[model samples]
Target: MFRGLSAFPLTPVDEDGVDLTAYAALVARLAGAGVDSIGALGSTGGYAYLTREQRARVAEAAVDAASGTPVMVGIGALRTRDVLALAEDAQNAGAAAVLLAPLTYQPLGDDEVFGLYEDVTHHLSVPLCVYDNPATTHVRFSDELHARIAALPHIGSVKIPGVPTGAEDRVAALRALLPASVALGVSGDWTAVRGLNSGCDVWYSVLGGTFPRTALALTRAAQSGHADHANDLSDALEPLWALFRRHGSLRVMAAAASHLGLTGEVNLPRPLRGLDAEQRREVVAVLDALGLDE
Candidate 1:
């Protein structure tokens, strides 16, 4: 049961490979910050960009550094076999749960998506978090499909991405549709307060990994019904969120981490470049304005 906030830590990479030292330190920071769980190899972690071996090493490092905090490893892949292989690897590495997104080259239909999760859930003892991220996967789960997945054995939670307009109604509808056992989490830090206050059980946050103290404070405020405080905190982080929207969180986060001296210059896998100097300067200004220049 990964309730509250689950921080999705970045997998710092260099010319050599995944930087285990930086990766572990990030995980330790999140665990010590008192987040409910750590999500390794997530979109923030660049799971789709890593080789199988690299992903395994990333999972192992995350679990080891978690220090009793639950670690949920992303096990999404283009193929069913690859997804299962990563899920098995996560289990062997002591991951608490596996998150699955319906990733495919061709557009996937409802039955195909259902079948993919069905096959994976059968082989696992640990719980699965149904990841409905249409932005990346391009496959959205309808309410009916979500209910079908939730009814499957060994499924624990559902992670819904984005906090679209009328999010309260969306949250209320999903809360009514999903089983009480399946907790819904809201991604996209901008929507976290609205989603959490709307009955989502957790915030699957990217900011939480890089700046856990502030993220945790916001979550606590939202959870305790401090709408004004939560709104103030969300407003404070709006500048960084604006950059996240413009340049994408992956690039902005890598730049943010390096700016904070938490990692070396992160070279994401090929075809992805970090922020240009101009964008980096904007990030620096945002970080400094928010007192995150450390």
Candidate 2:
């Protein structure tokens, strides 16, 4: 189930809210191009920005566009009950699963992390995938936390960030303890092959957002033991990554969307920041070179 290309599509909103046409077109484009799954409200969708009620409405829109594809909703609220409520909303919207991120800030003890999982999983029937984007979430999935989540009956697994530097040996040690059923994958492309080679069972990515065809190609190549071929596309995708590495991805992506008329307001939450005119132009240039502009 965690095998193919999965995209995290942005939530298309305007001053009036919810641009169904833009949202539908994006979903239809990706689904038609062979993206195996779709995740709404993931980092790509600016999940943390939307209020709970707004997220519910946006999620409902996603489920309709999902059309039976494995739609995963990012359920990342600071509070446990609200997270569980979003998971319920995901289920209600027919989402295939909910992507849960651990509570951020205010450090959590091991027991607290496990308890959070137990609380959310209590009301969930669909599978739950944990997101370990520690840059924002602030807590890494320590080995003990991984073990606890894997033991849970409903958590399918996690989308952990790239393994930490100097942690390769530790990952080799850790992999032995992780169950095959609880798979792991990172979120970027150049790193994706490494992740897959490192025994991550799936590839959940934002690269899939603009380049689903290329992303699926990469996944197929890796799965077929053609990692070198995947590497070639990763090279082609380097410019996109460069945009992300230099400034930021989510903001650059919003600018790209505005450039393409996908959304009117390319806004990030307060203090998240955006690229200026010069930086935006550079991003558009890269996208233009990639033939990504609409």
Candidate 3:
């Protein structure tokens, strides 16, 4: 369940609290595309912005819409108590696994971070993926820290940020620290090809959420050792990657999904606006140029 392409769909929302209809449609689309797993409430899913009840509903909706494809729900929260609650909700909702990042308000020490995992894992009935997303969570995981956490029960996978292109050594070094049972998945859509080719076990993808076919092609090509073909596939989507680099994957994907009529015009939560008209026009052009809209 932890390996291969794990598509993280955006949790589309509007004036109505949790847009379950639209969000479920997105998950159904991903499952229909045959992604290895569906990751709900991940960063791209706007998990951080949602309330506990909203997230619980999203988790239930994703599992229902996934059509038996393994669903991994994000259970990250600033407080360990909330994380535990979210984890329980996800497990009860039939999530195959839970993704937890050490979400922070004040800076957390390594011990505090490890303790958070220890506390949650002790009560978890399902597997947990350690989400090492420094860009959003502000809490970074050292190799030693990761080793410590992965040793805990229920630690099934570790989702690391993008491995630099051609940085096989980095992946190898991290893999060496993890238990053989713990899968190493990569995030950051732009670096997926490099990360996969470098020997990561899974792609925890933002792009896969909205563009599963394109992302899957790239993932399969790399996983099959067709390095040149994978690179070519990634190059073909360079414009989209550029947009992701420029405007962030969350916003670009929300815009692209809206353009594709997969979700509403105002899908993001409050304080987070979708791209303006001009940026969206650029996205459309890129989608058209790459034949991604087809």
Candidate 4:
């Protein structure tokens, strides 16, 4: 199973579309920073915006970049058949695992939710992570239901999004209820300092995809019980995240990566827009102050 610090690497795009060279460079940087795995075509990758073929190219690029490290592909669709097809795609592509959320458009009952997972587990042999990104699905994961699903034969982990209200309590409950072997990860890098303090075992940090060395330093500090250092690093990021909070941030993050010389292509699809000039100024100032841009 993919564990420790992982990043959902954005798939780079340009006029030619799906910039493979840029995507590989992004993955190479993440791997060098010691990220455990690469998440391709997740929300960060604009999975909903990509065609099936583009998703395949992104997945192949990620696995190929890792060389030996495991790569995970996000299967973020509502239909059971389609998700299974994506899961099979991940398996064939040599991904370490598949990440998923509840059905889209319709609110699935807990039983139906469970059925989706059960069906997915049966259809695909690879280990899968239950992605409770209620921010995307518009339904929250209940503690009661989480306890019930921890024992399913094929589940390898659970990925709770960073936007969970009262996330401290949420992670605590998971620590209290879930089996020790079923790996638990938090996707909220903005509140990662607090999440680490809450005893969350895995930090699947999205911010690490930007300033990876700093992210690794923060993770190492947290792992070593050096909360003081970790908190300091988190403090350095407060301004950048504030800019991210100022706008619809799916594109802002990709832009932030670009401004740092990661890539100049911030090809965001519709329903999301790039950061305005003011927000970009704020990001640059914050990175400069942190010596991150240096």
Q: Highest TM-score among the candidates is held by which one?
A: 3
Clashes of each: 0, 0, 0, 0
- Which regions of candidate 3 deviate over 4 angstroms? none
lDDT of each: 0.89, 0.75, 0.92, 0.74
Residue 36 displacement in candidate 3 (angstroms): 0.2
lDDT of 1 by residue, 158-260 (tens): 9998785788999989888888888899998877788888878889999988988888999998889887898899988889889988998888889999888
Residue 270's lDDT in candidate 3: 86
By lDDT, the candidates rank as 3, 1, 2, 4
- Model 2 TM-score is 0.91
Q: Write the per-residue lDDT of candidate 2 for residues 141-238, one digit (tens) a residue.
A: 78778877777878786777754343346456556666767766667545676666555667887767756776787888877877788767777878
Candidate number with the higher TM-score (1 or 2) = 1
- Candidate closest to the true structure, highest lDDT: 3
Would you list the clashing residue pairs of candidate 4?
none
- Cα TM-score per model: 0.98, 0.91, 0.98, 0.92
Mark the 10 consecutive residues where model 2 has the least summed lDDT.
162-171
TM-score of 1: 0.98
**Candidate 4 residue lDDT tens string, 1-294:** 445677777676654577778888888878877787777777777777676677777888888887767787888676888887777877888888887777579778888888788888887677778888776788677877777776676687887766335767877778788888788877766777777656666677667666667777887788788888888888877776676566644666777777867776456665556777777777777778878862
The order of the candidates by TM-score, greatest first, is: 3, 1, 4, 2
Clashing pairs in 1: none
Q: How does candidate 4 fare on TM-score?
A: 0.92
